[model samples]
Target: MWHVIIFFWLLYYLIKPKYSRRSLYPPGPLALPLIGNLLSVWLGLKKYKYHHKLWQSWSQTYGNILGLRLGSINVVVVSGKDMIKEISSREVFEGRPDGFLYTMRSFGKKLGIVFADGRSWMNTRRVALKYLRNFGYGTRSMELIITEECLELVKLRKTDAGQPILVNQMFNISVVNILWRVVAGRRYDLNDDRLKRLCALVMRLFRLVDMSGGIISFMPFLRHVIPGLIGFTEMKSIHSSLQAFIKETIDEHRASIDVKNPRDVIDAFLMEMSTNQENAFTEEELHVVCLDMLEAGMETVANTAVFMLLYLVRDEGVQRRVQKEIDDVIGKRQPSLGDRSRMAYTEAVILETLRLSSVAAMGVPHRALDDAHLGGYLIPKGTCLLMAIHDLHNGEFWEDAGTFKPERFLTKEGNIIQDERLMAFGLGRRRCIGEGLAKSELFMFLTHILQKFFIRIPDGDPPPSLKPVDGLTLSAKPFRVIFVER
Candidate 1:
């Protein structure tokens, strides 16, 4: 057993980058012998916000860029605006880490836009952007879909009138509908078994990744040997389910392709496939892209909506101000993307919610393709780079960052000001593709819900704690809200 352990240790040392030899690597907690810093972020521990707290503490102790070890992997955590700009803007550090879990769970055999690096990523992203533009994402055509989803969501909330509703479910359903329209060109009923299972699986995976201490992440060698350590069985099942669903959807779209009038994203992708038979445009690639859209688009929008609703319930002053803005502009009509400018305060509320919530607290990890310098620290190639988005949201960059004040986004005279410090959608080339869609969904849904109902916290809870449950996303613990009919 000892010899076997020594052999694996030697192998890891050989394979991993030698960050310790680098003179300029940022200072951080001293990693233990073999375990590295894995024990500090144990996944099984309950109610621990190590990732968030660690980033906060590290920023204070070691400056903007801090280094740590997760087993043999060199992890670089970046905070502050200057450091973020320096890292994300560069092409070399643009790619994400190539890990076993990410490959298996996200890409599998498919080459989607999100996981595809270099030329493939560039091509896929270009096609996707062009297609989205053609489909009227930032224009009138997409607003119709957003309008329909918001109306449906508002109607559904009426059922829970005068009672606290789980806002997460409502947001989840609404966001899923929007993503469905974008991806598959069809929406599922709220109680659909497949939809429920898919949402649950995605949520579970988010939690796992946020707190992943699985053998695959910490000890890759034991992934096969220690079968129980990795959540392979569960992950495999989820992957199969997701792939099967995506494949069927793609097949249906292919069989009923109408070139003259493309229905949705799948139709657009099929058109791309027909035009570009060669290169990376495969059915497998198409499947992964659809999955990425569903997974990324759904949870983020939903989580933000939930946060917005929670804040509204907690703060009556902000709620009334937001509702007043909506009432003045929208009145009895359902809110749409067109009303964004007219509803300034409503938009401010959503922005403030994002600032406070910081969903996806530690923004997606970027891997250094080669040696990079930021804040006087050397970030060697293949080091897992994590951006402390939460710190930025709560840092000195914004006036009273910790407070949930929407007015900070508005001038004293009430003109709206766009702050670049709001890095919730991230920055630079790899910034979220769905930023426009997310903004539309967030604004439309929040306006409709607020206009239709008065939200309030339940009797006992203290405003559903602003402190988020740590993971890949900054998720709130299960909380309830009362939706009083307007």
Candidate 2:
């Protein structure tokens, strides 16, 4: 009798529905036991190639707040602008997920700002922002550094002005060097082989991340079961190489120490670690923080710039209009941060690029710190919250949502309009810390390039495809452009 009862229990467990018909969670498709919605998500990814698109498709059936269970994890995808803002602003929903992929990046534990949560995350984020700001992040002083790098890029590209050159990774070195200056007190030459390798590693890192956090993130046992076949080895190798590089840089900073005069962000962090004993500011934390800076800053800014250029090249009329604006205000003069105000059309172009490209398609996943109600449904504690950012930008709020129209962000009076619906940098507490620096770089780099060159599609070549190569961030497909000197 005991054996029969045990057998029935086991069978029920294997075939049970993860979400019952009378569940309080938001309405969603049926989720199977153990696997839950993994198979459906996988199929969606195979069809759409982007998580935001997949979630948008489901939202059509289940309304804005769609719920699901991927293995043992409960996920709530919040679409619609108002609902996204609600979740983004709530304190109870600011936690980051502590899954295997997140911890694996920080040595088998959550340690950095991007993945860590609670008190430690709060402290690290506070310190990082304070120090990064002190080192000229989002400041006028940093504008000069970006200007210098923009000049270098302009000089390098001048050599191939008439020839078709691949522009996909063109902005990587300049963008990374700008952040490196703040983080490490140095910059890399555009041709540095080390910079090339580092950029490759960063690129590979983004590709490894699945829109649904990968199979290993949910089924972590796969690492132990089929480590070689399941990309575990490659992932580990990439992370180890990146950490080693950051460690080497930190060691050099330690050798040439200056406590009183903090040379850069690393110096500031080191000083904090030395003096503040209460926080979880360790050497490992420092390494991971620096890695976070590079990976986060490099991919977002570089790819967005490339995407901006891709759009401009495809639309010569738009390109000419922007150049006209650049010519009208600050023509042939170096573009300072102040110039950004008078250049409304140029600002609109940047805004349109961010809205259309939506590099961070899903943005970083947020976790529910406590069980809470959103969109008339219960989000249990430990549920992963995915803010459908791409959907928000392209959904009902905007007219001609799919078209690349900078004018959509502009008013009839020739002024830039600030639409709250465009949450490209995300919203609330976990909003990207590099937003200010990113905007500065985009304005300066784009203005400088447009002031000097006219980006054109090469003769006899087809127009570049607007379709993005999807991954962690939406990347522009490989294409070449001729930078004709104006």
Candidate 3:
């Protein structure tokens, strides 16, 4: 009789819902037994190439705070500008999800600013930001490096002038070079084979993983069963090679460290590790932080700049207006960061690109640290939180949010309007650390290109579709442009 009682108790415990639907938890689509909403999510993602859009579709039916279950994991997607801002500002929503795929990126554990949380994330972010700024991350000192890359890009494109030049991943190398210089005090040659391979690998890594962390994240055991079939082997290989590259760079820096005068971000981090008694700063942490820098620094800015060019090519009037602004303000004088302030319409174009592109669409998933109340729902601890940033940027709050209009970011007086709804880099403490540098790079690269060349679609080829190719970041479709000299 006791054995029968014990068996029934176990069954009941196992079969019960994690959170009561009849309770204060947010409403969502019905989740099936064992699988929860996994199949539904997969099918939705198939229809909508991007997961944020998938969430947006569901948000329409269930309202802003839509609850979901992916296997044993619970998810809450916060949409609308107000809900997004509420979650972003709250401390409980600042934690990073501890899923299996997240561990795969950083030596079988979470160890970077983008994916780590609590005191460790705090210390590493604070230190890295401090030293990165010191090494000309957002400062005027970076202008020379960016300007050199801008010129290099212009020179290369000039050779293919009036001809079709595919720009799908064209800006990757230039953007990576700038990031490498800041992180390790070195730059890659434009035609270097190693740089080309690195660029390809970075792009693939991002393409493989989506904002939802994929099936492996929820069902990690499946990797051992059918690794190659599900992309586990490839992702592991990519992470290994990328880590090796970062470790090699760190090894080179370690060999020639000048303690008093640090050369770059690596040197400063090493110095901090040696002196800081806090156990947070480790070599593993350093490796992961550099990896974060590579992905965050290279991917978003590069893709955004490319998307900006794609938009310019599609709309000649917008393109010519931007060029006119550039011509009016600088007049062929070597463009500098200072000119961004004076070029209102040009600045508006950049802002508009960020708004419309919405790359990093989900803006790095945040986890709920504790049981918290948000949007009048009971958010249980250990729930994965996703801010519907794409929705926030494109939803009804704006006037015709779907259209790409730089004038939306400008007032009647032609001054840039600072809208709280435009959260390209995100909001709150966990916001993108490299925002300043990204803005500077976009301003420098775009202005330099527009000033020297007229971006046009190759003759006889229809205009490139403005629809983004979905990935971890929203990428512009394959498109070519003729750099007709101005």
Candidate 4:
């Protein structure tokens, strides 16, 4: 049969001698006939928690700067701090790839800030960030908003709680409220049907992307052929619903537009669109841009905070230290950015959690704009580049990186020692634009949490498994805990 012949040919391709001196690509495992390392990546994704470990191993064996052939593209992963910094800084590495799944979320075009590139990326990024900051995104006012949300969460939490609930779910609600206020100029209630639905849809998309080994991204055609496979059907259905909601929200914003007194990000963008037709400002662009902010703003820091809390729950000693630090600094008062300096241990613990989690493991891949030479190897134009942030934290770069020791980030004098390697939010020209706001939210929420209650295993229970579920962000599996009052 033809299928048998195809299988044998594919197996022969894998077993055949690989290209070596003839190719200029960096060293990596042998690639199969047409699929390249697609099978390897697919296998790794199937193993979820250990998938990152696989990539780390390759980085170790092939050296810090190495290449991987995933499907039709070649990826050069930079793991060394110096190499990543050197490469990510250049504009040549600032482009984004146009893959199937990557563009599918954007209505078959590169319309959003996250996956956007070149002139449009620069222009949109500038305006969006400028207005975001103007609306108190990273300032003291934003700190106050975060503090209010923290207090709200404290009230919502059950004292002497007997059951372990999904804290990240609680976090998503609060984070989305904050982001909604910034983006659309309003916050939603915990029971708001639209808000809850959007949150679920976002998680679905993240899970689908992760489950597919990102194969769906490059080989998007597979979705058309096998629509029901890999939760693809569910993801598309959810995406459609989310698109409708986004469109509705945009129309709502339009109904009450105030050009001179733009109320929030939506109003500000509408004003800009009204004035600047030459720029790529349209209703579709607005829809995707707002979508990008909502997803990024809600998930990144919130999930990172959950990872931190999960670790704290597993280690009572760390939790105690965090509480003691908070108590000493603020003495039961609500904590703020001002308190962060004195509470060095608390900050260190959170930072250590981020380094370990490597939430965005390999950050959204960057595309090379032009052919270039780096690390004594040629990087072809349009080739994809990935920064192995996870590998950077391995013991080779950080002392005893595998161990969860917050003390490493602290000096003997008890001050938090800042390390450039803690680029958990990333760095260079394409670093996360929302870093400042994310930090503010993380500090306020976790400190207030420790100030209010003690996190612990439920009575008559063993320690819960801390193994994280894989997705766009690595999150702790749903586990129960009792919120014992301090």
Query: Could you list the CA RMSD of all candidates, in the order they appear?
Result: 4.9, 3.0, 2.4, 5.6
lDDT of 1 at 460: 75
The number of the candidate with the highest lDDT is 2
- Per-model TM-score, in order, reads 0.90, 0.94, 0.95, 0.91
Write model 1 residue lDDT over 1-486, tens digit each, in one string: 999999999988976665455557788877788877677556413334557766677668877788887887888888888788777799988877676666785554425666567777788788777776776667786788788877877777787687767666566766777667766778877767778888888877777655222347657776678655566666778888878888888989999999989988789888878886666378777777888887888888888888887788778999898888888888997677778877778888888999999987878778888887766677778888888888888887777777889989898878888988788988888899889889888888788778888888778756787777666787877788888888
Off by over 4 Å in 4: 1-22, 44-49, 211-213
| lDDT for each candidate structure | 0.77, 0.87, 0.86, 0.77
Q: Rank the candidates by TM-score, best first.
A: 3, 2, 4, 1
Q: Write the per-residue lDDT of candidate 4 for residues 1-486, one digit (tens) a residue.
A: 999999999987776644332166777777787688878776765664455666777777888777777777777777778987877689899988776666777888887788899998888899888888888887777787787778878877754255666566668878877767878878776667778778877865776664223676656677778878755688778878878988888889899887878888888888888887787488888888888987887877767878777788889999988888888889966788898878889888878988887778777778888988778777788778877777776547677766678998999999988899888877787899888777778888889888988998776666655566667666667766677767
In candidate 3, which residue ranges exceed 4 Å CA deviation?
A: 1-22, 277-280
lDDT of 2 by residue, 1-486 (tens): 999999999988765653442277987878998998999988888998777778889989998889998888888888888888888899999999877888888887777788888988888899898998899887777888999999999999898888999998899999999999999999999989988888888887787765557777888898999987767888899888888889999999999978988899999888888888886489989988998988988999999999999999989889999899898999778878899899999999999999999988887889999878886688889888888888878877788888899999888999999998889988898898888889889998899999999999898888988888777788888899999998
lDDT for position 65 in model 1:
80
Kindly report the root-mean-square deviation of model 3 from the true structure over all alpha carbons.
2.4
| TM value for model 3 | 0.95
At residue 139, candidate 3 shows an lDDT of 69
lDDT of 2 at 189: 94
Candidate 3 per-residue C-alpha lDDT over 257-299 given as tens digits, one digit per residue, 9 for 90 to 100: 9998899999988988888765638899999999998887888
